[model samples]
Target: RHGMRLDAADQAWHLSTPTPYDPPLTYGGWNQCRALGMRIASLLDAREQESNAGSGHSDNGTKRKKKKHKVVIHTSPFLRCLQTSVAISAGMAQFEAPKDRTSSSRPRTPSQMHSASPKLPLGSQKRYRKTKLRVDAFLGEWLNPQYFDHITPPPPSSMMVATAKAELLQTEEVDTFTPTTTQRTSGGSLWNGANNRAGSSRESPLDDWSHVTNALLHAPIARRDRSNSASSVGSNESSGRKSPFRPKSPFRHGHGFQPLTSTMPKVEASTYYPPQPHYAISNSDTIPRGYISHARVNTVNVDYHWDSSRHLQEWGDGGQFGEEWSSMHRRFRRGLNGVMEWYSQHGSEERGEDALGLEQVMTHESTDDDDQEDLVVIMVTHGAGCNALIGALTNQPVLMDVGMASLTMAVRKE
Candidate 1:
């Protein structure tokens, strides 16, 4: 779980450290993730069969070589997501490779496997070891200042990898409680009565993150100086009565979306007035929700309900608060595009690995075969990032209410 700081008066709203699952995931949650993994595995198996069928033997009786399919999984830097990805990976391992491929010596049914836990079958482990899992920092939860009551930084990369490994270890043997040994002994339990309940109920013990490298660090807190605040530019008392130019509205879409330009100045929220108790103001003229008033209206606060300092920190000194929206869109779009490009390039000719360090193996395409190469890319991210991904894939800016552990699938059109 992540936390946020929403104190508007506090300019440098800091992001807290990520917290592990309090009670830990229920059995049902584990089952759902495992099912998703199984589904993905099944889909890949079917695709392999299609490829094999389409590729007829050469002039000799020898079988034609099939393209090597690589499965790349990208996950958010969050602890919970990393845990879920491990479960899904284990579930995928449960699938037996095709019999004709000489990968599986014997077939094992559901009853023969340990479906109750996230453990991979002994044989299946070796079969899918090459499946790559990488943490993509951009895939972390959305950094919308207005939406969060408390903002938490992502887990360090090493810690995240360790958590995933720990989750995987849990499936090695059956246990009533899924939390690690450290988690079990660290804190008090929910039931504090006659039974003298054990195990941690709130926070899990912190891991030794000293050696953790590649920590996914977010924007640093901005300065608290009010002189540098956007409001100062408007308050020019030398000869001015009032600056006619107002700051642009921060909303990305709908009633008050005033686009930002090079000439426009940034705006900071001065005060926030909570909604009034009374609904009607008898004879008084009231502005409708989401509507902006035009008559010398200094009431428009671009940083309304938003921690503009966070955005400023992310974008640097001269950047506007709303700039984060476009930046995020570009980040996600590039990531998705890179994944597709990697897939397309690796399917045919071999090339040197990219900056991401993903190993690209060469594969020969059958001249007579007309079928396209298959690629499986799994992205485990937070709800907001998921929405951003959807927006990027569809080339439309959208905001969707996404919940925990929700799954979204997108297919690129040929």
Candidate 2:
């Protein structure tokens, strides 16, 4: 039943099989198959050991010739046959994955050439282009051989490195400028008047909001009329200031909606209490959905400062915009009155957690185990075929690290 036969003339066992032979791989059959392989290995090992021992002892003048008898030896011609077969299919060595030719019923789109869905390419994934581009995709920068042939000396008069390019870069830097501003302030009544009109109910903040805004609109005109009439009546009531702050906002958001910007008055830097300073955010951060931040107005100058020690204990952290700029950098620049100010001020302890919660979200998501390690060998007959197949596998990222070739090399060396 096994695929092996003896060739008496050649004095070896040769592997013989039915033309369309198929080996068993069921639970019981796999064990039998392994046992057959183990038997062949043992026979080969015994022969090699005997050959080495015989050579060492044969140096004596009285060497004994091996006994010739009518021995029914189970010489393995199968090993020689398999070695020939292996040499023929050497480059075709590969792990055969079961193919499912059936197609899925799901609709296909042009964006997806196959069933694989493309990742959203969201959040920290954007940074991979900047951080891992050299190691990942070469883009215009792969160091291949075609360009290496053109090494040349530059023209003698050229000051290439230090003088020419350096001055041009510096000139571009100093030439740019921004307009300066003078600081101004609105009366306190403008903000205080709006703040008093807090929404009465989550469903109905508009009614209460209307009362506060009405008083604000009338307050400005009332003074103008009073001042002109005061000129007629000869009194100093108009000389006094209207309320510095006002109740202004009817901040209302519900059913997954944010408060409208119209509720909050926009202040220009020149007209604000103190001029707002521009904070440079070198890192771009993505905001998690539904992160609420209480905007605690800082007493410091109008420039935003996200003070970690001072404000974050009270208000929640800033939304996507307020995350750590550089986790690698030990220092954090908190904006006291800016975007960072709003995020760290929220009180909820379990706040800002989101969909992308795992470390894999920030790292390379997959590792190919075969590409990371090697395989085990079954027989000495696998030597030549294993090398050719291994060369093919090594060239492909998908097929690499199959150490079967190394096993074949070790067998040949032995």
Candidate 3:
């Protein structure tokens, strides 16, 4: 009942024997995520009120700027995870929607530009502008052949991208109009063309994401081709095998369904290799049957500015055949570091004005007087991945099985 969005019989079948097809969240999962989103909103609302009450007066004799509460959602590119984010965004929107602001009721701070409505009908749901959700490859489920009886074929980047938009379109009135050249070009170049300053002293994991994000947003198949060609050129001269290490995909997973290359013995071109997963996904494939239409495309509400690098993927050379426990720790540590960087940039008053588009950034210097508000980051991933993230942040293993749509918080005190 809590797994994939399949019929009771099919769901049971999948539970016993997992399928290769990427499944969307169950109806129950959607509702759970929305409730979780509301809880988060309530927590943030309380914190904001407390912060406002604590500040007495400004030393400058002038009114202080009102702080705008910001929430950024980073989610796995998997169908279920993306759907979870959409539902969470909807929940937050519903919670924050002002109730009778025109009357005597106290107005909700960080007012919503969207109309106040408890439930948004499908195909007409308005976009929740206050929260920005991004699909992050690093947050994807652990991908190693040894974990399962059969390796799950990774979904194509385009299909994942398309499926995300389709889900948003049905549940949240996303812009389904054709994308402009600027919108497409901007997203594509940010990742493929950005410089990776891995060696720089001040460099953060954020610098390595432009390429991966670009692939996620636009021309992923093309990027795959380029990556393959580049790898071929750098093949080991002695053995004539592609280099096990690829700078673009420092980690084994996340970059779509391209052939994997490692120090392990390579399968002969003539030898038949069983399709690792029960089914193989190609560029022409669509979302699982009965899922939303994978035709819509939205670039506005989903930010592509800061995606995680393939370097942070769950498995790689660090963890031979599969991802070792230590590799999982390192993976989440790097992911946490990158997320902290995102939090810092977003929390700062100097965040790029362009990046604040559509997001509510209330800062009235006239009547408002408060310090900067705290920023909230919602990360969507698998249950075990949740444990890994908790392990990374807390430096202790709770060894508990994380439930579906469960929220585990780690507050940063500075």
Would you estimate the TM-scores of all the predictions?
Answer: 0.42, 0.13, 0.51
Question: What is the per-residue lDDT of model 2 for residues 1-414, given as tens digits with 9 covering 90 to 100?
Answer: 112212322221123433111111121222222234334334443544455455423556644443211100111112222222222121111112233356655667866777675454323221100011000000011122332233322211122212212221221111122544443332333235554323223232322344666676677533345436434332332456433332223442313223543333443221112122243321111111111010001110111111222332232121221223131011111211222233235311112332253322543334333221111122221222233233433432132233221232222221
lDDT of each: 0.45, 0.25, 0.53
Off-target runs (Cα >4 Å) in candidate 1 are: 1-26, 57-63, 97-130, 150-324, 342-374, 402-407, 410-414
Off by over 4 Å in 2: 1-95, 100-105, 109-374, 380-414
Clashing pairs in 1: 3-150, 3-151, 4-150, 4-151
Instruction: Point to the candidate with the largest lDDT.
Output: 3
Candidate 3 residue-wise lDDT, 8-111, digit = tens: 22434345435444666555555567678778777777776666665555787765555546677777767677767766665666575334456546565555
Off by over 4 Å in 3: 1-9, 12-21, 59-65, 96-128, 144-147, 155-300, 304-306, 310-321, 346-373
Sorting all predicted structures by lDDT, with the top scorer first, yields: 3, 1, 2
User: Which residue window of length 10 is worst by lDDT in model 1?
Assistant: 300-309
Better-scoring candidate (lDDT), 1 or 2: 1
**Reference-based lDDT, residue 340, model 3:** 82
Residue 317 displacement (Å), model 1? 18
Model 2 weakest 10-residue run by lDDT: 130-139
Task: Report the Cα lDDT for residue 142, model 3.
Answer: 61
